[model samples]
Target: MQAVILAAGKCTRFWPLNEKHKSLFRIMGRPLISFCLENLKRAGLKEVIIVQGKKRDIENELKKEKISGLKIRYVIQEKPLGTGHALKTAYSYLKEKILVLNGDDYYGAQEFKKVLSFFPSILVKEEKDPTSFGVIVPQKNYVKEIAEKSKKPPSNLVNAGCYFIPKSILKEKIKKSSRREYEITDYLRKLAKKEKLAFFKAKEWSPLSYCWNLFDIKEILIKSLKREIKGIVESNCQIKGRVFVEQGTIIKSSSHIEGPVYIGKNCQIGPNCCIKPGSVIGDNCRVGQAVEIKNTILGANNKVSHLSYLGDSIVEEGANLGAGTIIANLRFDKEKIKTVVNGKIVETKRKKFGSVFGKGVQTGINVSIMPGVLIGREAVIGPHTLVKENIKEGTAFYSHFAGFKKEKKRI
Candidate 1:
């Protein structure tokens, strides 16, 4: 049996962070697709088919990794259609039995095993908000009916985008959806009427559909990491709990770490720095003196040097945070932080959500950013500025907010 990984997504939501496909987005020093493939590897399946678009960014990485003799194949989806159309593109490479999965999602081994246990089943899980997803109607462990967004769903069980299907599905006629795209759920719903579609309820599913999903995914990845200190720990350093310090990483004097935290290869963590739990600092990064990083995901080569506090944030690759910079994770009201995505207020559903800085972003000294803000790629944030809104990609901002005693223009 083989697997079909759907990766050809025309992504726009993961802005600044993704100039390319979302599958190529790095998480914990690995691309998002890497985790999915790793889960497939853990599930004991070797042969694979990946459907991607023009760039083939994922293909390049997979080839470079050379995943230990893993037989891999790729198909280009010229048109940016829905999942149903993507699966159709892999018709030439389909096997007698295949597991169809989303490429950007990171599912655990236990759930994949459950889906594989049933050859003709669809993996599903109970979601809190089923209206936004394809809801499943189960009857005696088999899928009775599948509905996409009803006023009232039959059940809370939603599609986790993992399916066990025959190769003959490629021959089925799929009609275009109302949105002018072909959806796999519609095809599966129709398929359920004529054939057997078993259902397996999964216990864990971590989807990377939005930016906020990274926080939970990062925490899950960090927690499962084993403790290994491959780097140098200087004197007067306090290491509590399990921490994975990769090779060439050096923790200087007077730094304290509370783990399940990870420091990637060649990282330079400094003196008087406090790295709290659930933090993952990537390769060649620098965390300088008097800095505190709490549960933040600092990408490779980022520099947060001196007197900075990063809490529950995501700083992409090659970012530079100047001294005395602070990213506030909590709102004054303490309510769930909401970010405006494409002029729509999308709730992050996080009470302690910090800002997301894209690749190569630079900040001047003493910059302060509000919660749920997004700074674009290669953007420049000037000194003593207060960021209250999103910054566009490749833009430079130098605005500051200060209340004047009288009616006057503020910085």
Candidate 2:
């Protein structure tokens, strides 16, 4: 069987951090996609086709890793069309059976094994919020019907976007969706009517759909981190729990790190610093003295100076957080943090969600950012200000919540 990995998504929900399709993001020196691909390789699958857009990051990474002998190839999805159109483009190359999956989600080996057994099946999982997705109505382990956004789903098995399509379906010449685009859901719905489609429940799965999803991945990585010191530790440091200190990183005396925490290569955790669980300091990062980071993800080359608290936030590459800065992850009233997406306040389902910043963002000293705020690429925040809303790309926003000045003279 062949595998068709659909990576053509624009990843709009992830916003600033995923402005580009960098699906192969590294987790502890290994690309995230690598983890998925290796699973397929170990399962003895040789042919894998990756559907991508104009961006060649995925293809380039495959070459950089010298991943050959698997008949790995790429198909260009010229337009930002639906997933159905993407699979149609790869029809000519598909043979007897094809495994369709999203590139951003991680499905365990056992799940793939089930797919290999049931060649024409859709992997689903029971979810509380099935209305947000195309849900499946199954009867006795077989899919009865699929209702897209059904107010009352017959079942809670939401489509995980992993399908085992037979070659016969490709010969049917399925038509495009109503929006003038082809979607995989339409094809599957048609197939479900014609033949009995098997369904398997997911044993382990994770979706990289939102900005906070990185926190889920971080927690997964921290659990796998080895509790050994590969790097040098200067005297006066206090390290506990399961911490993975990569070689060339330094923890100066007066620094305290509590794991499940991961420090990337060549990083510096200085004196009087405290890093808590789910904290990932990327390569060449510096956590200065008196800084505290908890449940945060700092991308490469970030510098968090002294007297800073980065909690439950995502700091992109080359970001510099000034001293005395604070990232408020929780609200004053303690409600679920909601982010404005496409003029809609979408609930993040997270009580503590800090800002999501793109690369090259800079903030002045004493800056304070509210929960669920998103700062665009290269945006700047002036010192002693509070950012309560989103900042546009490359724009500088500054506001002091001291007091509003009254207009004395009317012109």
Candidate 3:
């Protein structure tokens, strides 16, 4: 069997990080889509057709991996349409029964095995809020109807977006929904009445529609990473638990590193630093003395050669952190961290979460940022700056405490 991975839609919700394709985002030094592809290869689905849009980042990434046993192809979605249109973009390539999966979601191996067991199956998961997913109304071992984000869903079982459908399903004429786009589930809904649509329950599902969810995804991927140490661990360093240090990475003496952490290749860690659990530092990252990095994901080539405290944050590629930089990761009343999304307050539901910095962002000394703040790509934060809100892309923020008046030198 083959799989058609959907990588088209514009991930606008995943801002800052959205500058790049979400599937291209790295977790534990690997792309998100690579995880899904690995499981598919193991499940005996060797051929894959990826439906993508605009950018060729996903296609470019696959070329570098050169993953064996997985034959890959790409089809352009051209315009931003619905999932149905995205699938249709690769209609010419669907010669056999295929498995369709969302490229951005992390569907583990267990879920893939279940989907392959049933023919014409749609994998569903039990969700707390079914508003985001297409709720499946089940009848015995098959689906009766699928309500796409209805006001009140029939059941809590929602569509996991992985489908196993025969080629005949593609023959159904695509109809546009109220949103003015074709929906794949609408076609599946039509088939449900005439035929019994097989169903499979997914054990794990992760929706990466929000940028804050990066922390949770990072934590999940890190727990499964094998503990390997190829870097230089100087004497007197307390390295506890499962830690993977890539080649050329150095853990300077006297640093305390708690486990389930990954230090990427050529990373320069400190002589006096505390790398807390769930911290993933990418390649060529430089961390100086007395820096404390807790539960965070630092992208490739980030520099923190300064006294700083980064807790529960996601820093994008090439970010430069200055001395005395502090990221506040909690609210005063201990409530959930809520951020401003399109001028509206959106609760993150995370007890401890920090700011998200985009690529090439730089900060001066003594910069303090509040929780849930998102700094966009190529942005700059000046010295003694206090950030309490989100900053857009290419913005430069500076602090001015005193008025510039050459009045008497105050001598």
Give the range of the ten consecutive residues with the poorest summed lDDT in model 3.
Answer: 214-223
Question: Model 2 lDDT vs. the true structure?
Answer: 0.83
Order of candidates by lDDT, top first? Answer: 3, 1, 2
Error in Å for residue 54 of model 1? 0.6
In model 1, the clashing pairs are none
Give the Cα-based TM-score of candidate 1 against the true structure.
0.95
Q: Residue 304's C-alpha lDDT in candidate 2?
A: 88
Question: How do all models score by TM-score?
Answer: 0.95, 0.93, 0.95
Clashing pairs in 2: 84-183, 84-184, 236-253, 254-272
Local distance difference test values of all predictions, in order: 0.86, 0.83, 0.87
> Tens-digit lDDT track for model 2 on 194-296?
9889999986767788777877766755665778888989988889998889889989888888988888899888888989888888899988889999988
**For candidate 2, which ten residues in a row score worst on lDDT?**
22-31
Residue-pair clashes per candidate: 0, 4, 0
Provide the lowest-lDDT 10-residue window in model 1.
Answer: 61-70
Best of the candidates, lDDT: 3
RMSD per model, one decimal = 3.5, 3.9, 1.9
Per-residue lDDT over 1-411 for candidate 3, one digit per residue giving the tens place of the 0 to 100 score: 789999998898788888878888876677888988998988888899999887878998878875788889988998877998898889887976889998888888778889888777889989887876678888998999988787688999988899888767878886788888888897788778778799888876677878887776676677687888999989899998999999999999899999999999999999899999999998889998989999999999999856899999999888999998999999999988988766777778898989999899999999999999989999999999999999999999998798776677766
